[model samples]
Target: MASSSRSTLYENLKLVDTVAKVKTTVKELRRQKEISVDCEGNNLSREGTLDILIIGTVNRKVFLFDITKMGVSAFDAGLRDLLESGCDVMAKLMYDCRNDSDALMHLYDVKLAGVLDLQLVEIDSRRKSKQNHWFLKGLKKSIEVYDHDEKSERTKKNGTEQIEDAKRNGTTIWDKRPLSPDLKDYCAVDTVKLFSLLKVFRKKMEREKMLEASERYVDYFRSYETFPETKFYRHGFLPDEILRSNPRDPKVQYNDCQGCKKKFKRARLDLVNAGEKKRANFCSCCSRIITRIENQPIPSQSFA
Candidate 1:
């Protein structure tokens, strides 16, 4: 039961097309207390388009639901039910679970529960490692080690080349009617890697007695009500947060507006309160502060 052998045996290719197939898949998924789930798509949250949903069970079986071919109805309630039930009792494995969670929420209003995000586990482990050189490892690197470097150079090179080609195509391939083998392989490996990497990570966590901590982090990850905004789409304060905090707090500092390049000292706390609320680096006069800020950076302020 080596990770590499298990991955090779599963092959990551099981297409579920019919309602009966969906029901069967759900039945199988519900029976497992641990499973890995992944999705392939282009700007999933932004475009709300998905190519495939790969669900891998603890037994190394993967169900590849071709979203385009089968349509949302094929997997809709069954898929959501599996995930919803999984959240309560099953350990759902994923890498970067936040994005996947967001995509699921946007596309189908599915809220993923009971997720064990390997990436966060890796991060938590890295943070606790005594070695100074410890760093977060990506899924590919995690899989490479589990594979014991047995992958052929040509396969690795071809994967890299194909990935670059897909990047150049810029979401075009995501919309392609029939998935090419190369793309399918790429998508399949993602879910397969989750399964394989979890074995490696789980063992490490158990050995270090940090498995509980890793599981605890998943609850923390799930608590986020909304995804933090990036800089380009940054808006000042969220209306809800703005209404919750005091605008008159004197602790708020009015520094020169980074966006307006103004020295207007008379503006008072209007801009400072706004900036602090939005977690903006500069005043609201400038571009919407281009990053999400957790309240810990500021003193005595709670993230509203």
Candidate 2:
């Protein structure tokens, strides 16, 4: 039960009048320690994790749990574990993992790590994001699931089990609902199988030197800079980062950023040479910092 596994949140969605996409994804991610997971089905324009959030850990083990309709207690227990431990086990857990720190904190109450990303890995592996966009899908296709033992199979719940039982629960599989005791074992088996799948997939990637690629892809998506939506809600980022009320010039030595059309003192070095220039050189903010970057440059040094 270590390679790959996913458990659906059967009634959770119905309980909360929401969709089950979040739980399904979390189940997929929870199994694989070193892998990539995302939900293309969701509308990316949205800001919530309900939109799509892929999580991973370096411990060679990572668990994804979807709690869209879940209560506060369920989240607090899991969140407190990560926050108090201060481990990298929970790397990416937000819709915009890099910039959505505020969202994560509000939801999960934790600070994330600034480690490597799968995007950089993909670049190193010489793969295009477009072609390799469905990395997990490809992996899923490679894995063929079947029954391990017919005798161990549990009774059907929604009848889809019977329709698909032959293909899924052969003489080898033990698939069933988690609500019942007989099926509870089946549920545990799914969770364990997930762990197994991750182990296998991760090993395969590592053995083939493709781990870097996966990591890079994950990183690239994590670092993606999404624009603010109407909600103005944020996660991970501090109060200073979420709002651009006092945006500044990156190239200027010191001063508030002038509007794009205006001009200001140029680089101090350039000013030192002529002592002054009447041509009116614009500061970096006016020329390109604000207009071009439109972001607080990744600070060269972090106090942390």
The candidate that wins on lDDT is 1
Q: lDDT for model 2, please.
A: 0.30
TM-score of each: 0.63, 0.31
lDDT per residue for candidate 1 within 1-304, as digits (tens), equals: 1112134535546667566777777876777878888877666553457667778876667677766666667657488777765444787778755446666766666766667677655655555575422234666665665544444333445656865687787634565755565555556666666766776667566422233333333332234444333431223222111111224446554344333332223232222344554332333323323223422222222122
TM-score of candidate 2 against the unseen true structure: 0.31
Q: Among all windows of ten consecutive residues in candidate 1, which has the lowest summed lDDT?
A: 237-246
Error of 2 at 263 (Å): 18
Evaluate all candidate structures by whole-model CA lDDT and list the values in order: 0.54, 0.30
Residue pairs clashing in model 1 are 87-113, 231-290, 259-286
What would the per-residue lDDT of candidate 2 be over residues 87-174, giving only the tens digit for each residue? 1453332122333343444444443333233322322233332444212221122223322323223322332253355445442122
Clashes in predicted model 1: 3
